[model samples]
Target: MSRAYGDDLRVLVLAAGASGMSARAAAARFNIGIAAAIRWLRRERETGERTARRQGKPRGSHLGVHETFIFDLIEGRWDWTYFEKVESSF
Candidate 1:
């Protein structure tokens, strides 16, 4: 996936607004997409900041919360025959 434009590029794009350039024109001038330029300008107008927004929530394992319980279950299952029976049922 492509990364977001940097703060410097954002600032330059927004400066077009101050010079009375339309979002579409600015985007064309900078060779960026019109939607991106419009979104960035709107963000700066609403939040008064030109920095890139954080993308999403931090990464984590789905099984992390049950790690200890899963380990205990594995350790408690002493017989290979029990595992084979469970696998066959599934």
Candidate 2:
């Protein structure tokens, strides 16, 4: 299934609303649809943490530090010119 940006935003809003105001009132203030606001409130009640996980520090960099390419680009290597040209071609 595809991602729902609206649902995600509603979840965030719901969480914030639960902390500050009544779910119905907060949802009404935000002008979110009534059904969606109720759904969000129920889902939050069911799960303390909504869909996404809390991000934490990872063991290592996924890209592993592309130092050589970055250094070459910074130092004005002639070979680097083709990279930009190729990127533009796409």
Candidate 3:
């Protein structure tokens, strides 16, 4: 699973740990299994914040915004006159 998934699971676990609901109630509310909810809550209680982040390995698309492209644009990649006109309107 990805780090985002772990973060989501941690959020669910935190929801379960809060005083407003039972395991089944939490599971149904979140559309997860009761067993899984209990397990995650237990793991969070036992492991602390370390369990909320990524583990084991990396996989999937490495999509990211390129800093160089941003820098070039900031330094005037598009026509400076066009940007100047837009900025003046703002």
Candidate 4:
């Protein structure tokens, strides 16, 4: 889902809604998901905005917060068995 649905498609879907087509119908007409049509319509109706927003992960890994801990665990116990390291990390 790196690619947000194109504005070209959004326009068609929004046009269908404006012309009294159901989201399901518009989705079928445009070969998209019912939820996508529904969301576009709802956003237009509520906020009067029809542009696609940024999609996908907002930032880096959650485990970033534990970087130091992970590094210390691995470096401090180089001789430990894999199972021992795994058990200690948890």
Give the lowest summed-lDDT range of ten residues in model 3.
Answer: 1-10
What TM-score do all the candidates reach, one by one?
0.60, 0.39, 0.41, 0.61
lDDT of 1 at 42: 88
The C-alpha local distance difference test score for the whole of candidate 1 amounts to 0.82
Q: List model 1 lDDT by residue over 1-90, tens digit each.
A: 578888788889999976889899999999899998998888878988778877777789998997886667667774547667467445
Superior candidate under TM-score, 2 versus 3: 3
CA RMSD of all predictions: 4.6, 10.3, 11.8, 5.0
How does each model score on lDDT? Answer: 0.82, 0.64, 0.63, 0.89
Write one digit per residue (lDDT tens) for candidate 2, span 44-82.
788764554324555786545876755656576455566
Give the lDDT ranking, best first.
4, 1, 2, 3
- Candidate scoring better on lDDT of 3 and 4: 4
Q: How well does candidate 3 match the true structure, expressed as C-alpha RMSD? A: 11.8
lDDT score, candidate 2, position 35: 69
Error of 1 at 68 (Å): 14
Candidate 1 residue spans exceeding 4 A from truth: 56-90
lDDT of 3 by residue, 1-90 (tens): 533445665586576667667667777777777886776666766776425444676775453455665456557645567667457545
Tell me, by lDDT, which candidate is best.
4
Error of 3 at 71 (Å): 48
lDDT of 4 at 33: 88
